[model samples]
Target chain A: MSERALVIERLNKIFTTPNERVVALREIDLQVKQGEFITVIGPSGCGKSTLLKIVAGLDVEYDGKVELNGQQIKGPSLEKGFIFQEPRLFPWLTVEKNIAGDQSLKDPKVRGKVHELIRLVKLEGFEKAYPKELSGGMAQRVSIARALLRKPDILLLDEPFGALDAFTRSHMQEVLLNIWETNKTTMIFVTHDLDEAVFLGQRVVIMNPRPGHIKSVLPIELSFPRKRSSLAFQEMRRTVLNEFEKVEEESYTVGAGI
Target chain B: MTVEISEKLSEPQKKKINWLNVTYPWIVPIVIVIAWQLVGSLGFVEEHILPTPSKILTTFGTLLGNGELFYHLTVSGQRVLLGFALGVGVGVLLGVMTGFSRLAQEVIDPSLQMLRTVPLLALIPLFILWFGVGEFGKVFMISIGAFFPVYVNFFLGIRLVDQKLIEVSEILQFSFWGKLTKVIIPSALPNILLGIRLALGTSWLVLVVGEMMGTSAGIGYMIQDARAYAQTDIVFVGLVMFALLGKCSDSLVYAIERKSLKWRDTFKG
Candidate 1:
């Protein structure tokens, strides 16, 4: 068995307003192994993004424990790379400079690494292009390259392709799978797309809202480059969809009783 | 065959368009000048009341020939440079401090805002009493005029930096200095540049008012002296010089802005 990269034990998160305390996550427990790809799929208000934020140490105000390699998660570090929905590329910086970030590009090693990541993300001949000059898809690719520049222990993506069009979204999914194959870095992707969850994740963790807890974990027993139109792919997608349907029916019944 | 012919014709056509682009801005000013010269030549207005373009040009030429214009220009230019530097330096420093530290903003911003509202011209009497019509008093007045715009814009720019980018900085584990230099400053650059342009114009206005009172070597002094002698042509010459210098400074800052803010995707029109 691969060593555990991240462990969450009875994690609970609440957001307090002036009038009320909202439970964003409840009794959530999951473990991610090193080099494993985990996709968390949930509807809006499911707290999947909140869960990722906590793990990334952007939100440390949570109950229970989130340990990365036996160390309690405290605050953001270079070890945990985060990719938000938007590319978040610095407008002033060129593609190469954005990847290099605060690290001086005058160093040959840093320059070489930036070039390598640029190629890895397939942004050739665009090293000098600013964020404004690039397309939405290209900007997001640059963002992915930036996240991988530090060679982080884990990368957390919060619906990184949610803003992209359907065609670009699928293309980006394939690109992400290629990066995962090459780097073998642990990734925890949070998305609402069923096809995306099944297409990339080795294990899909389905989540439900209204208190926000994991409904079930479905392991995808499939090979790489899984065809979207194939029977098995459709079957797995249907299973995940059925999980959501069951949750909806139960919630409706509870509503009727009330 | 048609494509080749069109390409050959477009060569001169492109040049014509470029020429028009360069000359269009001068059309209105040139027309006004010609009409004014016609009016003067036809005796529609006295030269003392409204000096003819030809009369102003001759006066300008005499001043240039004797090196008087150059000397006055240099004197006023030097004062503007010193005062502008002092104002911009202090404004940016305090702006950055208040931008980063909430406590500094709380302690200093209200006082600065109150001072900003105070009429700068009304302080001339107080400045004269304190610094006594010397170089210091004029420079101080100019500096005070240049300070407020830069300070306000820079403070607002820093405050308006995108919170998302700040989160990106946190994730990258940027140090305080790193965040300020890499994220904060670059993001605030557009507003800062705008502030600088406004401050430059204010500096010139204040310089004219300052020179009108105190020292007797600047362009403003020359105009005041011309007024005393009823030499309207020399006064027109001084006014023209001010207009030319203001336009030149504005163009310089505009070029800097274009170079620095090339990354902004905005509507050019």
Candidate 2:
């Protein structure tokens, strides 16, 4: 709905554990244009989660600024919706209730919008079901529906389908792509899956290990409805894999550590 | 793919349950009662001191005809109901506060913990001295017994709410009270119900002990009065009534738990 959707300026994050001080993110700079779909891929503990947290406003102790449509993020707000790795549905609520949980849905029109989001995520008949009855992928689908119901400018996803099996994971990726195409919301997804990054992201940002910072940004020029078997897609994957290998060789942290 | 087909196939069927869930419980209780009757008939024990099932039932019928049993039952039930309601209500309110706020938890948790250390029955003399061996004293003891389990459960339930759900609530701009009522309370529900169950049991027990020393009515008083008249069958009736009431209340709570968590049972393995 607005131009220049999100901008992250030189973000820095440090974690103080009881016995150790670990740098989670350092000097991160990024820009996500309106309707842009950006996926981040790296080794585990590369501060991908930390970056998403900073954008989602869950962690504010970091340095630098995160803005959505020129407004600075003071804390977590309805302007940006987050889908965590775990579905995290309240066990007491039904699936429909879970998806419609955000405060903005207090509006009657927003209630109608939640039904649309549920259909978008392909959970049309599951409104009455509970999270416990659903499989891992199904619960995560409800979570995505929940996030989209807020109608945020940007959708921040931290590997929403990471816990699912491979086939379920692929199906979810397609669902995610379909949602992106229809809504055109700027989505910043953090994942460790290289193939996932190549398939869904318009541009894939690769980060080096902890005290994580972006090492390279690889543009995925392949068009949507991207065929996994396409030679162009395969070639792009090969190139990205080569670059990732290089970063892994030079990584300094355990996850990104060479 | 194999998964593509199954993904659309709906949920997998769970294994069939065994007969133990229903028939065996009923059978075991019946067998135990029959054996006790047989043993008593065979002169295995003195009938006057240890009344048989039939003798107890006969005494129960006589007591019922005289309204003696109903009077004690009514008195004990009233105390349990009052104490249980008061204890659970206060425990839940305090528990919610402690769970949500560090400062409140810091102030109240220590005193509540200390209060739990003093056995509730031990306070009978103090209660009599304060309230003059009356209905208030009996109700107070039951309330004390119910408080701890309810409080502990409420506290644990609140603490156990998933951190990510809280994050979701925060991002949505839910106010503190909104989060407490909508998110935190619902998330903590299963555990809270568990606390209520434990408190119910504790309250039942305290009702018996509370009436044992201080009251002239209730099952405890009935048993004490029967002892004076050597009406061992009447005492047996009181014991049987206590057992039945306790059993029925626990079963009621269990049923409630099942009804509330029905969705969970279907969804989870």
Candidate 3:
């Protein structure tokens, strides 16, 4: 694995809706060393999704450059796997077909990899079930296997488990951590859940609401498989919580003066 | 929460349905048949104008014994099968081209939209003028009737494919053709199947009218022939045959739709 897998520098994004020009992101700069798990947490309209889109090369209209493995992101490529909030699995396809859908993966060698991925996601005995028949968590597991099929260098996820119930959400977090440990692939996840952000990120980047940009980047020194209730984990969570309150108070004061 | 609520609500639905409700659809037909039989036995109307049920049954028996009924059925079946095949083939091909290409849609859609507004039944004289008093005119009429529904449904189905699914395919770097085969077509199948069902019904509708115009050796022609001779019993037999055939064909298409969409978990309500 390469050392510097992803770099975003001086990134800016403005969405031009019919009625208004919305500044979605402003002067955002972030760096992820290879195999790092970074979580982005912000309020609504904080441009977290836009940031992931830029990194995935889904939106190139943004101002700054995003480089992956020394190559400037131009457009969507198979190298960076993306998972949306919804599972986004083709409803018409069965579980196995959805994961092994790429024509190149039809080869017997790559097909074996698909089976391995199915097992990795714990979707055994569901090889032939359609999307409608599976539960939401089960469907998302298939989506994860689909992204991992190409062995992408980086995985960008946008609120992937936000729609799931609490039990499913916690289980999915554990499953994701296990997959990350096994693959050691660089992952950047965007979520609004504070506990989720702290639980998943090796480094948590908190962004402010208006003119969305990173307000702070806090690094967690705790070792792998960190307990959520541990002193170090709780300390990190409180630190992230304090930054949110500080930003909220500053915004409130500025609004009152104006 | 939604799943839990739906599961609770589903419990009563899973219980055995009422026996009366199970047999509900057949009730009206049975009542109507019994009423007709009573009217015939009571001599409520003249035998010629309102043929008795027994008279109609006897007519059916004779027609079957002499093989006349089979001949007319074979002729009508052949026309419908040929016209339906030709119409569906052309419609699907054009539908795919228009759906896949903006240029094709620009050149084709407006013209098709105009044609669709013109009642196809009113084109009988025009067809007769072109291919007069022959099998060609009758078959052409049936084909025209079948074409519009198929074309309209296929175009709409292809265009209305979910954007989210397309985006996923895009992220996977699917080729244009790959997207069409795997994502677009499969998603569009429900609408396409609806179009086929509508097209088949139209085929039957136009078949009767087509055979009634300048034709011989069909159920429609036999009805017309019986009316001219004032053979009301034979006319009744012809009408009943048409009803049975139409029901059979529609049920066949319905079975196909059920088989193809077995994966879907539609709400019973």
Candidate 4:
């Protein structure tokens, strides 16, 4: 259970813009335990998404070492699944086909697995629907389902519910929590919502904006089906929110009068 | 419950709801034909110059019965098919090369741009002189006419393949052939269809001119030959046959395009 799922060492990302060198990430180190749910909370432009993309191997032009399952991550593999903010479903495919997208899972048994996950995500009966026909929340569910379809060991979600409504977001969070419980897939979710971070994470990591680094990592110490109104849950949310605010202020001072 | 409501509805009611599908295309053509016929019958023009629906039908049948019409029609049809195939084949090959390599793109793009600028029909005299007034000259003319559109489309289609989609393929480590077959071609199909449509129309135009001015066979030749003998009705029949052939070929491409894009067009509403 204590086996490391991922290790990020001395990560730095500098983009050579037309006029100046922009630092997106700086000297960041992160480690994840097997089957742990880690939520990264930060203000927008805090490079939380950039960190996730780097780990996903979607962006490799960074000074970093991201290792998963005892091997260095160089590019995306079936072991790691990525869910974007938008569904980004291939418009030419139906939900069922999208979930089965470009996978080697040709076994008829795998299809049964897809149908089960479809129900787990509460996307049953809409399997044949196109992405455009689905609501924002529904489409995001399909994205999650598609991510899970590969049976990935590590699932990296970049604010998958950010565009969804409050009710829908809560429902999807619940669905995600349930799936994590059953499958024990290592998840690293990036979001700006502190409550969401507290709601989903076994540990909440707050990142600072501009030259983004982990400001703090707070353990939730809560059980599954976490009560939104519980005192511990509220306290975890408050502590993370304070850390996020302090990081924002600190970044402002450093970036002042530039 | 909403899913139940949507699913439980009868197919007939679904059809009724999408009545536009049933009526629009069918109705528009009928209306246009009726209007054209009524105008012609109501003394809009002399019968010898402009035939009504009934006169046109009689002309169509007589031309078919005489077997003179098909002799010319086949020649134009064969020319279009042969040239169009060659043009599209070369275009796709060149387009793929241009799209994949920066060095190839620089070399090919300049050449393609210059070649596309040349009017294919203007090369008719040159084609006749180079290849002689046989089938090769006309086939070459039609091929050149079809080549440019398909090349441009195939090239642009390769370049515009969504970068994200390519990333997905790369992430999966698809084999070279697998990526080309599964990702590139499907993504490029719509643009490729557009090119095919344009190229076919251009081929028809080129074939007609080639056959009319320089040959003794084809619907164009029939028209020109009729003109020489002052056979106005035969000339009109040839013109009508040209229109029909053009419509039929265009519809064939369009029908296949619809079938291919059925899933994509589902979002049109």
- Against the hidden true structure, what lDDT does model 2 obtain? 0.85
Q: What overall lDDT, based on C-alpha atoms, would model 1 receive against the true structure? A: 0.91
lDDT of 3 by residue, A54-149 (tens): 888888898886899989999889889999999998887778889976564558887788889988998776776788878899898999999999
Two-chain DockQ for model 3: 0.36
DockQ of each: 0.44, 0.44, 0.36, 0.37
The residue-by-residue lDDT of candidate 1 on A50-83, one tens digit each, is 9999999999999998999899999998889999
What stretches of model 4 exceed 4 Å from their correct place?
A104-107, A256-258, B2-48, B51-53, B172-178, B265-269
Residue A214 displacement (Å), model 1: 1.3
**Candidate 1: which stretches are off by over 4 Å?**
A252-258, B1-17
Q: In terms of DockQ, which candidate is stronger, 3 or 4?
A: 4
lDDT accuracy of residue A7 in candidate 2: 83
Native-to-model Cα distance after best TM-score fit, residue A77 in candidate 1, in Å: 1.2
Best by lDDT: 1
Encode model 1's per-residue lDDT on B23-83: one tens digit a residue.
Answer: 9999999999999999999999998999999889999999999999999999999999999
Off by over 4 Å in 2: A16-23, A102-111, A252-258, B1-22, B40-46, B175-178, B265-269
Best by TM-score: 1
TM-score result, candidate 2: 0.89
lDDT digits (tens) for residues B19-51 of candidate 2: 777787799789988998988889998887787
Better of 2 and 4 by DockQ: 2
